[model samples]
Target: MAGLFATLAIRKALDKLSSILPAISLLASSSSAAAMVRQGHEQDLEDLRMLERTMHRIHATLKDAEQHWDIRDESAKLRLKGAQGASV
Candidate 1:
């Protein structure tokens, strides 16, 4: 799931970059073109950073869930063993 999110984020960034490309060409000789490119690059970097943070959070959540699941399984097994012993 985190991989899926990361892939989607990359696709979105690429889409944004493609859209910006034509505009950059239109203003190729203008000083503002450099500024625009710089700003766009900075925005993309920020977006990627945000995506990385989000992925980290998602990974942590998944790890926590898996740990809880393991604990639950162990508890269930112990209960089952105790119940069988009592029956015997």
Candidate 2:
């Protein structure tokens, strides 16, 4: 469930990145594009930076969640084993 949401969020972020890629490519191919970036693309650049930070945070959070889930899963398995042994 957590993984599902994380995957969805990552996909959304990737979609956002795809939208930004053409502008980035333009910068590489055209001096006019470079000038446009210098003159009017500050907001787009800021958005990219913000998305980068969001992705970093998401990655860190997903790592923590995975560790927690692993611990919880192990604990649940042990509890189930203990219950079965008592019943027997």
Winning candidate number (lDDT): 2
**lDDT score for residue 23 of model 2:** 83
lDDT by residue for model 2 over 1-88, one digit each (tens)? 5354554566576577768767865664564556665655656666776776666566565545545545357675464344333322
Question: What local lDDT does model 1 show for residue 60?
Answer: 53
Each model's lDDT? 0.50, 0.57
TM-score per candidate: 0.43, 0.44
Error of 2 at 25 (Å): 6.7
Q: How far out, in Å, is residue 77 in model 2?
A: 18
lDDT by residue for model 1 over 1-88, one digit each (tens)? 3333433454455466556655654444343557777677667656755655555554454444434534347675464344333322
- By TM-score, how accurate is candidate 2? 0.44
| Cα RMSDs, all models | 14.7, 12.0
> Which clashing pairs does model 1 show?
none
lDDT of 2 at 82: 46
Per-residue lDDT of 31 in model 2: 49
Runs of candidate 2 with Cα error greater than 4 angstroms are: 8-37, 69-88
